[model samples]
Target chain A: MEFRGGWDRCCGEARSCRMLNLGHGGVRRLSTVDFPQTTEDLSLLYKYFAANQAALTRNMKKNKQLLEEIHVDLDIQEHLKMQEGARRFQQVGLFCILLFVGSAAFGLYGNGVVSKKHLTKDEINIHFERFFRFQAKMGLQIQATNDRDISISFPIQYLNHFEISSIVPEPTETRVEGSQVKYAFKGRDELTATFYLVPQQIGQIKGSVNVNENTFSISHFIFP
Target chain B: MNPVLRGIAVYLFVYVIFRILGKRSLAEITTFDFVLLLIISETTTNALVGEDFSLTVCFIMVCTLVGVDYIFSVLKTKSIWFQVASEGAPLVLVDDGKPLLKRMQQSKVDEEDVMEAARLTQGLRHMTEIKYAVLERDGSISIIPKEKK
Candidate 1:
């Protein structure tokens, strides 16, 4: 007999082929049908299959427990992977924050926010510098050790724009050399010379006095 | 300007900006968020230092900032009002498998976030399986699954 039209053709001459061709959906339909089968039919089918009801139930329970165990294990592994990723991210974030804070602190320190230079009196005396705005009186103290009168020359390189007609404590001799005034004076022993400067422009004044090849320079600023 | 005063002003200004932007602004980090954070820091650095370049000033500023932060933390711990003002209270977004739509909308938390939490914690596949969802103060969603029948 040819078994072809679903369950109606089962148990026919083609029963074995039909059973093999019945896929998962067909098997599920077959189970639903068997659920309402008569007791005699169930017993006959169980006998034909040669399986005890107790053994089938035990095997089914065992498979279900195994599946649940696998699911739980997979879930735990996934959770652990997520936690590991999160922990790595946290570590990287913490490292970045620390690096940023360190960079900021270093930047502040490098900008001179914490330390400053403290110069000594000798250094300042050697430099002999003063800053002034507009006109101001400036004095240069020169100490002479020998009794011989020493001639000194001060190069007025920064007072070109100033009114030289109003200079105080006039120099003994003033000579012009390439837009610069060379003020000469004679000093014996200790001497202090005072000069008055009136600025007519907005800029800086950097002048120097040459005494026997030793140069003493002074810097001043004129504000607008 | 004094370093301590400048530091305090900058700290307060940044604090106010973050507070106005709300807590969710920092809950998740995107590329844009990272760039924005860098820009904010660069601007703050310029404002804090101006033209001054002294190591002592920087040290004083850092000290003042730490002191202010410590004082705020102490105050927050001592006073409930300060705590509430600084850190918001936890909000309930779901109760007994029903979504509190208004609360969810206000908190910017949608149903998907709650469902994701349920799935992560309880292997749940549907929103109906969750009994409660709370938006905690730390910006995380806490889920409670419905009892199994």
Candidate 2:
């Protein structure tokens, strides 16, 4: 008579099953009773697991030793180190290249390979912005035609080392404030002034001029 | 307008720019980075030379740059502070099979980088097998494998 059942039941019915490898070297055979059902079985399984772990550790050591004998890892390490060293050397080389190019540029540009930007009176007037410096000569130019007395006033605190070098038309009168200077001149078609000044300290300097009924202000920066 | 003076100024400016960009910038390179660097050099070249092309000016500029570079190298060797400031110290990314996440993040290093180093150096298959991973000064990783029991 032939009997049919689930795989585990059929295997259990066999006297000595050869259908599966139950453990290493096939020392054990597959059986439904292998499943732990009692404390004793559970303890036996735990021992099996611990033995397997120890065997795995031993095999890993052997594998490591074999790898060391071939020196494959060391060769790879050396090659990688060489590549890293080459890359680092390349970076230094790039820095040197930059320095070379920069130095060459300095040599050429400083000697006048390029011309300085020169602004026209109209350009300067159109972009009438305050200039900046630590110490510099400041030139002011104005145009007026109305027949009347006009005066220009500026803060004296902007200049630490101050001097008034030249004025196109001498002022009719001058006044001094605690931190300001006022110069009165007869309104003419054109006027110019050159001032030698040094900044008191590092900050923005604001100066204003009042002539007739118009007031104008300028601002600048001083380097530390 | 002296070439030597110009050379000094350009050197200082370039050094500061690179320093500001940070150290990792030198380790990795991209195509756009190459193009941008070329453009920067072209622009700064004109500002550096202005209009001068004299042989004497060229020679002096070269000499001054070399002298300054030599002085910096000497200083770096002599002073620990300068060395630390210019070239950063080596960092440890992994200790005893565990990754130091913060140091790795700060240095732009990662687990994959350490793993790669381990694989290359000791044929390690997993991060758990590594005992230590050091990020060297030149931006390379050095890995030490766990001792076999």
Candidate 3:
């Protein structure tokens, strides 16, 4: 019987080839012009080959599914690794901030910028004007000094500049002692003043003295 | 008073005084708030820890301050006229993605500062992306992003 399908033609010579080279490479040429004696026999053989092809296709689909599953697992692991890296980064940042704040607090508390010493005459003269300026800037009241001998003087215009809220001179003395020339004149303003003091100490002397409305510091000492 | 006790007193005074003033976020603290903080700290330090440490005196001072703050808060919350007098309302800096020129002048807030805040906090790169900007009570600008049509 002649088979019309291409599969019958291709498999016509498969029987002869299977007998000779079934285990080796061989092409099977099926004869479409002459074949099995009945159509029923051809149909049975076709059905058997079709069933095998269907089984092969199903196996291919299963293999594809396995490959996809492996890819998905790898993706999940990569995502978890990224999240772990971010967590570590946040922890390190927090640690750095705490360290910075702690060091700053320690530095502010432990460091002392001011020293204690007696004030010198020349040093006092130089820092007197600066002290006045500081007082004017901060608007702080300069109370009376403890010593009565230290003469205080300033410019006349300075008084008008500061509105002399209150004046509490030390010792309530009309005239300061120890100076032969106890002349007190207000320079340009009441706020600005020049006072002369006799040298009383030697070596490096440092001390703070209060003027009208401000405190003045004297550094360094020179002996005559 | 002891140093520890003095510190606790000062801390409590500061907390109560600030709470009475109003609830303002850190970002919203104004120049006035900064000045108040500095003055309060200086005053409290002298009153609490100095040689003349007196609990009665400190309490009296703190109570007076809280009283003043309460008056301001009550006025601001109840009457519109008093609110305008005490704590000014939020000013509209930008409306519908456009700068309010007149409002800016009345508010006394610099345009550059508002723009900088919007850009830094709200991620606003361009003026068009900002739908509205309001300067809140705490001296911070609240920006609303424009929706794409």
Top DockQ: which candidate number? 2
Interface RMSD of 2: 15.4
Task: Sort the predicted structures by DockQ, highest score first.
Answer: 2, 1, 3
Model 2 per-residue lDDT tens digits across residues B1-149: 45677788888878766654445566655799999889988887765565677787767777888999999999989986666555555555665555766557656678988887788888999876776687765667888776787
lDDT of each residue in B4-78, candidate 1, tens digit only: 777998898677555444445577678999999999999988767765778977888789989999998999899
Which candidate should be chosen as best, given TM-score against the real structure?
2
Model 1: per-residue Cα lDDT over A155-178, one tens digit each: 555666454434334557777766
Note the B-chain TM-score for every model: 0.87, 0.80, 0.63
> DockQ, in order, for the candidates?
0.04, 0.08, 0.02
Question: What tier of docking accuracy does candidate 2 attain?
Answer: incorrect
Question: Candidate 3, which CAPRI tier?
Answer: incorrect
Q: Which stretches of candidate 2 lie over 4 Å from their true place?
A: A1-126, A131-224, B116-125, B146-149
Model 2 chain A lowest lDDT segment of ten: A65-74
User: What is model 2's DockQ versus the real complex?
Assistant: 0.08
What ranges in model 3 sit over 4 Å off? A1-224, B1-40, B43-52
lDDT (Cα, tens digit) per residue for candidate 3, span A177-200 = 332112232322123232323223
Alpha-carbon shift of residue A20 in model 1 (angstroms):
51
